[model samples]
Target: MIIFPFGKAPAVILVAALLAGGWLLLHPRGKEDANLVLWSFAKTHITAYNQALPALNHAYPDVKLSVKQIHFEALNRRLLSSFWSDLPSQPDLVEIEISCVGTYFKGPKEQIGFEDLKPRLVESGMYNRIVRNRLATWSNRGGIYGIPNDVHPVMLAYRRDIADSLGICVDSLYTWDRFIEAGRRFTVEGERYMIELNEQNVGSLECFLFQRGGGYFDSLGNVIFDNPVAVATMEWFVPLVTGKGRIGADLGSGQNAAVLFYKALEEGYYLFFICPDWRSSFIQEYSPRLAGKMALMPMPAFYPGGRRTSTQGGTMMAITKACKDKDKAWKTALFLYTNPEGRSRSFKKTNIIPPFRDAWTEPVFHEPNAFWSGQKLGEMYIGLADSIPPQYSNPFVVLAKGKLSQALVSCTQYYSVNGSSGFRDHIRKALTASADEVRKYQKRGLIE
Candidate 1:
C-alpha cells in the first residue's frame, strides 16, 4: 500500500538523514533554555497552577511559564546532578518537597543549588508577611532556600459519628492523658481503635516529638532525637500501641496509604488520624461517605495548658541557580504563591492553607462546611499555624527519623518480651544508641 516518489535507495537515504538529525537534537550536550520552566513533582500543585495560569497570563503576557510534573525521586536526582554540573537543562524554578530539600543542603553553603531568597524576601518586606515557623523548614545555615507552600499544622481528625454514638465529648479530650484514657473505653479488641499510630511510622512519631519542643536537630544542627522530651514522649506513647489492649492501629503504606487508611476508618477499625490541612482534602476525596461524620480539633497537648499543635510535612518553591532569568522566575513564583486570587483557588483545590498572613483573611478560610460537621477548618488551622514550631531542615533528618523508628521498634520488641516493667530505662538506652548511630552517618560525607 505504499509507493516511493523516487527510487527506494534515495528515499531510504533521506529518511536516515532525518533520523540522524533528530538524534543529534535530542542528544545535545548543552543548550540555552528556551522558556521559563517549573518542575513540580506533585500533580495537585500542577493542577492548581494550571487553574491560576490565566490570571498569571493576564498579569504578564510577556512572561511565559511551562509547568511540568516529574516523578518525585527522579526529579530530585536530576536537580542535584544538574546543579552540580551547571547543566543548561536545569529548570528556572522548581518545587522541592520537604524530604528532598535536605539533600540539596548537604554541600557547603555557597555550593547550594538553590538561590538564597532571604535578601529578596526581606527587601520586599514579604518575609514578615509569611509565617515564621514555616519559613524555618526551608532555611539552612542562615540561608532561606525556598518559599514555603503551606503551614501543614497538625490537628486531631476523629470519627465524630463514632464519638457521638458512644456519647463521648471530643472537646473534653484536651490532653494526651485524657485521650489515652478515653481511648481505652471504646478501643475494643478488633472492632475499633482510638487513633492511627504505629511505633514504626517515623513521620507521625516525629509530629508528636515536634509538638513538645523536641525533634531530630537543634538550631545548631546537632542530633537531639534522644532528648528528654523525646524520651518522655516515647515512654508515654509506646504502651498505647502494644499489648493485648492496644488502642493504636497501623495506617498501612505505599502510594495508596491514604485510601487504605480511609477504608479502614469506614470499617470502624480506627477512630482518629494526625491530620495536616492538606490531608483533610485527601480525606474528603478518598473517603467521601464519611462526610458530616468527621470533625477536626486542635491536637491534644501532653498536659493541660501545653502546646496544642505540631507540624508534619512541607514543600517549598525555589529558583535554581542555573536559571538565566531570576527576575521573571521570581515574579512568576510570587504571583502563583502570594496573589490573593491564586491563593484562594489553590486552597480550594488542595485544602492547603497559604502560609502568607495577608491571605488568611480571605473568605475561603472562614467558610463553614458540612464535611467537617460545620467546623471552620481553615480558621482553626490558621489560628494554630503561627504557633507551629520550627523544625531544622538537615541532610540527617531522614536518617535520624529512620534511626528513631528503629529505636522504637527495638523498644516494642523488648516490651513484647518483658512488658512495661522496665521500659523507661530500656527506651532511654535504645534512643541513646539511635542518636549515636545517626551521628556516625552524619560524620560521613553523603555525596562523596
Candidate 2:
C-alpha cells in the first residue's frame, strides 16, 4: 500500500514506451489539429480509451488523443515533478490512482497542480449523477480536480456450493456475529477455512474501519486511531485468527501468498473472499473452473443493519494545470468517464463498475455475470455505492497503511504467543503508536 513514487527504472517499460511513442509519431492522424495527450499505468485503460476514440473523434472532429503507458510509480513521479517544473514531460490529462490522488489535490485551488473541475461538472449537470464520495475523494477545498473512472464498492464473495452443502443460508447471515457463527460451523473440520486473514495486506481492516465510520484520520485532519469504534473493530477481528474461532488462515504477501491463495481457492480450502468488483478478473484468470460456484453478497454489517460496504481501489482522470487547451482536455476526460456509450463499453469488457449513476441504467449493466451464477452483480454493487463512507484523504495514506500492516502483523504474533485475554490492549497500543508516527509526518508538513 505504500506507493513509492521514486524507484529504479525497469528496462522493459522504457522499451515499450519508446515503441508506443514511435508508433504515435509515425501515424499522421489528427496531426494538424488539437492534440490531447494522456498518461496512464494500465494498458487495459488505454485499450478502453481506444474503444471511445471514434466517438470522441466524431463529436469533436478536431481533437486527437495520444495515451502513454508507463510504470505506476514512475507516473506518480512524473505528475509531481511536472507541477514543479512547469509540466515539461506531462500530459494534458493523466490517470491518478486512488492512493496518489490526495497528493495532487493538496493546497489552495489556484496553487494546486490540477484544474478545478467543479464548474464543468456542475455546468454539465453530471455532478448530481455521479457518486458523491467518488467526487469527494479527488476534491480539496471545495474544488474538484478529477473525474471518477470507477466505483470500487467492496462485497463478500462466497462459494455457494460449499455454503449450501454445509446447510448455511448466506442471506441469513447479515451481521458479523452471524457470519462468525456460520464460519464456525463451516470450519468444524480442520480441512477448510471460512476466509484468509491477510496480515500482510491490511485492506480488510481498513474496510471494516471505514464501514464503522472510523479511519486513520478524521475529517478535521486529526488522527483518530484511538477511537472506540476502531478499538471495537480490532477487538472483533483479532479473535477470528486465534483461539477457538481461528477460521481464517493467515496469508502473507508476494508471489508465495498469491500462489497459496490460488491453490486454496482452486482446492476449496477457503470459502469466502472480501474484495471489490476488480477481483472478478483474478477469479477468471486463476480459478476459471470454479465459475458459477461463486456468488456475490453485501458484506455482513458490523452491527445489525449497519453499513455493509466500503471501497478498495479507483482511478480518476485529472487535467493538469499546465495544459494550454483546457476545454479540449475536459471534453476528452468527460467523454471517457461520463459518456454512457463509452462507459458502457468499458464496463462490458473490463467489468469495472461505472461511477456515473446514469450508466447503471444501461443495458450492459443489466446483463448477467456468468461467473457468478448469472447474478446481476452490477445492480447489487451499485445498491450499496451511496452507503460507502468517506476516507480521510491525505498524502500520509502510504505511511499510515504501512504502519497499520506492521501493527497487524505484530499483534497477530503476540496473540499466537500469548492468549486472547489482553489482546485488545495490544492492538490499541499498536494503533496509538501508529497515530503518533503519523503525527510526526504531519508536523513536518509531509501531509495536511
Candidate 3:
C-alpha cells in the first residue's frame, strides 16, 4: 500500500477541527441582542432617541436594541389592526400619548403591567422621583401602565409690550372677569380684538369646563356636558367667536390653528393666545424678531381666588408584554426619565420637560430663554406642575372629548350663521347624540 507517515496526523487534525466547530455552534455567544422598536409622531422625540440610544448601548454592552419611528396616529391604527389580525409583528416598547392609553389598555391583549417592572424602576429611583398623582399613577386595581416622560399644560401666552402699553397689569389679569376686561381693552372696534377663542381650540373647552368644576363625563360614566355648567361655559365662549373675539382667517383655515395663532401674534393681530411649552422653540425658529417680547402666564383662574391651571399635552412610555427583554426595556425607560445627565440632555436638545418631580428642581429648567426676554421658562412650567390635577384616567374621556369637540364646532356654526337661538337646547341634543355614540363604542369595547 502507498501510505504516507503524515496520513494519520492529517486525520487527527481534521477530527479536532470538526469538534471545535460543533462546540462553538452549541455554546452561547456572550452577547444577547434585543430587537427593540419604538413609535413616535413627534419629531423632537426622534431627535432625543438618536442621542439616547448610544448612551443606552454603552451602559449595557452585552445587549443590543433597535428603534423604529412611526407617526403617532398611524402607529395607533397599525397596532390595533395587528392585534386584530393576530400578526406576529409587534413592538417591545411603545410611546403613547396620555389621552390614548385607554384605547390600548382596554383591548383584549393588554401589555405587561408596571407592577411587574416596579422592582427595577424603584431601584433606579424613578418611582420615587415621579409625581404620584400626576400623569404617572399606578392603577388601584392592579398594575401601573405608564411611565410619564414629558408633561405640557396650557397657559396664557401674551404680548408683553401690548399689555404694558394698554396699562393692563398682567398679574391682575388672573380671573375670568379680569381676563374678559383685558381682552375688551386690547380689542379695537374693527381691527384686532382683546383675545381669540374658537370652537376649533379644544383647550378652550377644557379650560371652560375646568373652571366650572364640570367635566365631560361624571364618575358614574354618564355624559354630563348638557348640564348648566357646560351650557354656561359654551355661552360664554359663543360671543367671542361671533363678534367680540372675531375669528381670524387663519383660525378657521388651518390644520394647526396654534401655528396660525402664533403667526398672528407676530403680526400684532393677536394680543393673547393659549399655548404650551413647545411653543417656545417655535417662536425661536419662526419669529426671531418677536423674541424677548412674549411672556407665559398661568391659565386664568376661574374665580378671583381660584386655581389657575388646566392639563394639556404630554406623552408616556410603556413596556409591552410582547417585549422579550422586559428588564432591559424598563432600565432604558427609567434612565430616560430619571438620570440627571440624560434628562438635562433631553431638555437641552428637545425641550421635553421630564415628568420626574425632582428633575423640575434642576437648574436646567431655570435657565433663561433668550427668546422670552431672558425669562426663566422653567419657572413657568414649575407653576403648572404645582397645579396639575389627579390623573384623568378614563378612556371614555377621550371619546367624549372628541364628540364634545364636534358639538362645539356645530354649536359655533349655528351661532355664527343662524344666530344664537335655543343654543343650549341644540347643544343638549348634540351631547345626547355624542353620549349614545360613545355608549355604542363602549359596548363594542373600543373604550371603557
Candidate 4:
C-alpha cells in the first residue's frame, strides 16, 4: 500500500505543475483582446478601406476593426474639440489634410510616435514608394506623421476645338504670359471670354508667385509680399480679372465661376479654364455632352520652362496613439496606401489620384477617357503632379492668403468707389497691413 501511494502521488503532482506553467505562459498580464476603431472623414476612402480590410484581416484575424464615417469639415472640428476635452477615446486612426496636420502635432501628447510604425512601413515599401515631390513634402519630416493617399493639383482644362481654332497649341501654352495672350486672342465679343479669374480662384496667383521665386513667407517666417516679383504678378492679375487685357469676368465665388465656365464651354464661351482632376469627373457627371470636347493640361508657368503647379485638395491618413492594436492598424494603413489593386480601385471608383508614383503610369490613368476625346487623362494629371514644387501653404498661410486677398479687394473697391488718386499707394498700404498680420502668425509658429 505504501509503494502504490507514492507512485500515484508523484505522477499527479507532476501533471498539475505542468498545467499551471502552461497557463501562465499563454496568458499575458494586462493583455486584452485586439480591436480597433478607424474614424475616416473621406467618403470615397471608405471604398479603399473596404477593399483593404479583408487582406488585413487575413493577416490579423484576431483583431476586429470597424470604420466610422464623418464629413471632412465635421471631422476637423471634432479633432479641435477633442483637444480641449482631453478625451482618451478619440479616433485610433484619422484622415487629415497636410496643411492642418501641424495642429494635431502641436496638440495633445497622446499622438503615437511615428517611430512606432516606421519599421513596418519601410519593410512594406510604403515609405519609399511616393513618386511625387509635392506629396512627399506632406510626410517628409524626420518622422512621418501621415501617408499621402491621394492628391489633386490645379490644371488647365481647355476646349480643344476653340484652342485649335485660335491656332494655339495647348502644349505650347506653357507660360503665364503666353496663356494670357492666348486668352486674349481667343476671346471674342458676344462670344466666349478668354478666361475666368476671381477671389476664390487664386490658384493661378499663388502658382505665379511660387514660380517667380516669391513666397508668402520667407525662411525666417517673415511675411514678404512687397517684392518686385509679387508686385509684377499682382499688376498682371489685376488687369486680367478686371477685364483690362483679356476677355475676363468678375467671378465672385469659385462655384459661380465654375458654373459660368461650364456654361461658357457649352456655348463655346472660352477656350480654357483652371480645373482640378475631380473637375473632369464632375463634367462627365453633370454635362456628359461636353465629353470629347474637353482636355486637361498642366498649369501654365509664370515664365517659360518654370515650374507650373499648385496643390488643390487631397487627404492624408495617420495613425493615432490611442489605438490599442498598433501593429494591426499599421498593416491596414500600409495596405491601403501601397496595394496596386487597392490604389486603382480608389482611382476608378472615386477618381482619387494615387500617392504612389508608379501608379500614376498605370493603365487606369493612361486609359483614354471618353470625355476628353479619348485622351489619356492620366497624362494630364501626371504632368501636373510632376510640376508640383515643394512649396506648401500651412493652415495659417492659407488664412493669411485669404486676408491678403480681401485687402486687395478692398483696395480695388475703394479705388472704384472713391476714384483714388494713387492706386499704387493704396495697394502698398493695404499690402503692408496684410503682411503685418501674416507676420503675427509666423511669430506664433503657425507658418513655415
Candidate 5:
C-alpha cells in the first residue's frame, strides 16, 4: 500500500519510471490481439485494473489489459498532442482528471479525440446504473465520453480530541455561521486556530462555488464569473481569509506548502480542514502521529437547508477513438470499473468513494475506520454523495480560476486595509474584466 506523496516527487518519478521501462505490461499483447492499454498516473487506479485481470480472463478469455503510468499534466499534454498526428502512438483507454476533461471535450468533435461511450453504455443496459450527474465532467454536445471512477464529495474533518478538550460540540455546528462562531470560541493565543488557509490554492473557493450551485460555466457552457452567485460566494469567503479568524491566508505551494501543512497538523495549529473524502488517507499517511485524534463531519451549509456537501477531485476512464478493438476495449473498461467485485477492490485499495450507489449496501461500507476512532466514514460518504450539486467546467477554467483567485486576493487585501465597504464592487469589476479576456479565447476557438 504505497500512499502517494503530497509533494513534487511524483512527477519526477513518473517520468523516470516511464523512460526507464518503455511500454511495459503485465502480459504481452499478441499482434492484432484483444489487448487494451490504459494510461493513468495514480497507482491505485492501475492496481484496480490489475486486480480485475484474473476475472476479466475468465469472463472474456480474449480480453487482455495493460496500464501505462504517466504524470498527470504530461499525460494531458501528450493526449492532446496525439490528436495532431495521423499515426500517433495512443493508448486504448485514458484517465481524465476532473479538471482537465474540459480540454478534450471543448475542441471540434470531428477531430478524432475520445470515443463517445453513450451507445455502448445504452447497449449494455448499464447506462442508468451509473450516477448520471457523474458524467458532467466528460460530457459535451450530448456525447458522454467517459465513465466516472470515483465520487469525490467534500466534507469537513476536525480534531475530535481538540474538540472535546475545548468543550465544543462540533456535531451541532450545522451552518457556516455556527461554524464560524465556534471558531471564534475555539481560538486561543499560542494554540490551535480553526483552519489554515492557502492563498496559492482556491480549493475553498471552488468548494463553496459547487455548494452554491455555481461553477466556472453554466449548463449552456457560458462563462459566468460576474454572476451574482459567484460574486456573493467571493464576498462571503473574503473575510475568512483576511480577518482575524484563525485562518492563515498566505500559505505557499510546492515543498513549502507541504511542509507548512504538515507542520500545522503536527503542531496542532487548526481545528477544521475542509477537503474531499480522499484526504482521510492523505492525513493518515502524512501525519501518522495524529491518529485517532481527528474525525469526519458533514460540511456546514451556506444557509439553513442548503447543500451540506460538494465534489472536489474525480477521475474518469475514456476509451480512445483510435483504438483498433473498440468493442473489446469498451467491454474491458466497463467490467474493470462498473462490476461489483471491481468496485470493491477499488474501494479497498484506493479508499475512494465509489459513484455506484449499489456498492454502498455491502458490509465493508458499514465497517468503522480505526484511523478516526471508529467513525463510520463509508456511510457518511454515501449520505453526502446524494446531495452533491452538479458541477460544470470550461476549457478556460484554469484561466478563469486564476482570475477568481486574484479577485479574492485583491478583495481580501482591500478589505484588510479599508474594511468591507465597496469590496463587492471591487470584486465585480475584476471578475468582469477576467471574463472579457476569456471571451476573446472563446471567439477565436481556443475554447468552446
Candidate 6:
C-alpha cells in the first residue's frame, strides 16, 4: 500500500512517486469510450445532476452521461489514486467538496490533473455572469481547476414557535451583540439552549469569523488565521460555547449528529443555528415535522453595516485532464450548471443557489417557500448572494482547518481554566503559533 500520508513533504513526495509510477492500481482504467461518467460525493448532487441529463441530452444528444455517487472520503482517495493513473474507472468529470479540493493541488502544476477552465469561462461569456468570488476556492497557483456549483450564503434560522413567545422576530435581526442578549433571555436551563455551538467543532466560529472578514487564508493565498478579526471572533464566540453560563450546546458530530439534531429539534433544545443556502435541504429532509414552524433570515452582522452573509459549505465541478473527451465533458458541465430549467429543479430539491447570474431570474427562485413559514427563501438567498464573502482555498488550508480548530479549543479551554482575564492576549499568541505551524508546513511542502 502506498500509504496516504499527510504532514511531511518527504512522505508526500513518496506517495506522488508511487502514484505517478502507477503503483496504486494494478489494473488502471483507460477512458470509458461509450459514456461520460460524472462522479459526485453527495447523493443530493448526483440526484441534482441526474435531473439535468434530459437538458444535457437535448442540447448534445450524442453525449451520454452516467451520474454516480461516491462516499466522501472514498471518493477523495480514489480521485487522488486515479488522478495520475490511466484509470478506466476515473470519471470524465467529478464534483469535489471544497474541504477536499485543496488536497488534490498538493503537488506541482503538472501533477494537478484538472484542466484550467479560466479560458473557457471567458470564452463562454460566463466570466462576468457568474459570481466571480465563488471561483477563488477552486483556483490554485494561478490555475482555475473547477467550476463553482453553488453560492452557499450562510444565514440564521430559528424555531419561530419558540421565538414568538419571547416577542423576538427572527427576521428582524440586527447585530451579534443583540443576538447575544437575545440568547441570554431566550435560553432556559437544561430543556433548551440558544443554539448548537460545540467546543470541539469550530464550524460556527468560522461562519462568524467570515462575517467579520477573516478566514484561514487571504485572497492572495496567504495564511491569515491569526489576523485580528479571527482573534476577536474567537474571543466573542468562545465564551458562548464554553464556560458555565454557555448559551450554546454540543449536539455531537457526524452521522449521529443528525439524529441528535432531530431529537433536539423536536424538543426545541436549541433556538437558533447557522443556516446556509444548502443546509435547508438537510433541515427539510431530516426534520420535516418542523415544517411551517421555522423562520429563515440573514445572519446578523458583527456591526451595523457589515456583510449580512458569509459562505459556509461549498462544492465545485472539475473536468479531469485524463478524460479523452474534454469538449463533451465541458459541454455537459456547462449545460447542467447554467440551464435555467435544470437549475430550477435542482434548486427546489436542494435549495443551493447556482453561482450563475443568468439562472437567478427563474420564477421558482422568487416564490414563497411553505417549508420556511411562507418566507421567500430563494429571494432572500439571492438578495444575500452578492454579499456572500469568498472563501480562499489552498493545500495549506487543509492543515489550517485542523490547526485553527485546535486553536479554538485551546482558547476556550484557557478561558475555562483561568477565566477571561488575559484570554485575548492568550488567543493572539496561540493563534499566531497555530498560523505559524501551517506556514512551516507550506514552506516545506513547496520544496516538493
User: Best-fitting candidate, measured by TM-score?
Assistant: 1
Q: Is candidate 5 or candidate 6 better by lDDT?
A: 6
Q: In candidate 5, what are the lDDT values of residues 1-448, reduced to their tens digit?
A: 5556765598678878986677555455667543778899887777777777889899999877777789988998888888667446899888888888877766676664888888887887667666667767767777888888878888888788978988889778889899878777766645667876554367778788888988888866788867899899887877776755634343467768776887777777778887687877788778878888888889999889989998888888888888999888888887887778887666654567777777778877777888777888878888888788777756777877887777767777787887778888987987787778777778787542
- Tell me how far the alpha carbon of residue 134 in candidate 6 is from the true structure, in angstroms, after superposition: 0.6
lDDT of 2 at 197: 70
Q: Candidate 5 has which clashing residue pairs, if any?
A: none
Candidate 3, residues 1-448: lDDT per residue as tens digits?
A: 7565779889789889999999999994876465666666667777767677777788766546566678778888887676566566777667777667656545432432222445555686666766664533323224466687766655777788877777878788788777876676567755675665655656667766754567665543456766777777877776666643543222654678657766777877877776666655666677778877878788778787677766666677777666777877777767556767777876766555666776687899999887777788777877676565544545576877888888778778887866667777877776677667877777776432
For candidate 6, lDDT tens digit of each residue in 1-448? 5554574788878868998778647777777555788889888777778777777778898998988888999999898888767576788899988988888888788888788998998898888888877888788877788899988998888898888977986645688778888788778768788888878777888888888888999876679989888888888888898776688887778779879887798789988888998888789889899999998878888888888989998888999988889999999888878877877888888888888887788898999888889998988899998887778888877789899988988998899998799999999998999999999988888814
Candidates 3 and 6, the one with greater TM-score: 6
**Model 6 residue 272 CA deviation in Å:** 0.9
lDDT tens readout by residue for model 2, 28-57: 576344387899998889888887888888
Q: What would the per-residue lDDT of candidate 4 be over residues 1-448, giving only the tens digit for each residue?
A: 3354568878788779999989988975775443777778766677668667787777667756677788877887786676556567667677776556545543223342322344555787766666545444444233456677666666777777767766778777788777777777767755667765563345556655655667565543346676666666665666665533445654455558667656667877666666767666777776677877777777777767777766655567777665666777777677667777777776666555776776776787777787788787766677667555544434355666776676668655655554435766666777777777766766676322
Q: List candidate 1 stretches off by more than 4 Å.
A: 1-34, 254-257, 446-448
Q: Give me the overall lDDT of model 6.
A: 0.85
Checking candidate 4 for backbone clashes, the offending pairs are 192-269, 292-371
Q: Ten residues in a row with the worst lDDT in model 2?
A: 2-11
Error of 5 at 307 (Å): 0.3
Write down the lDDT of every candidate, Cα atoms only: 0.87, 0.80, 0.67, 0.65, 0.78, 0.85
Superposed Cα deviation of residue 225, candidate 5 (Å): 2.2
Ranking by lDDT: 1, 6, 2, 5, 3, 4
Number of clashes recorded per candidate: 0, 0, 2, 2, 0, 3
Model 3 clash pairs are 187-194, 292-373
Candidate 6, residue 162: Cα displacement in angstroms equals 1.2
Candidate 4: segments with Cα more than 4 A from true spot:
1-34, 59-63, 105-125, 135-143, 189-191, 200-204, 211-215, 218-229, 254-261, 393-395, 414-426, 441-448
TM for candidate 3 is 0.81
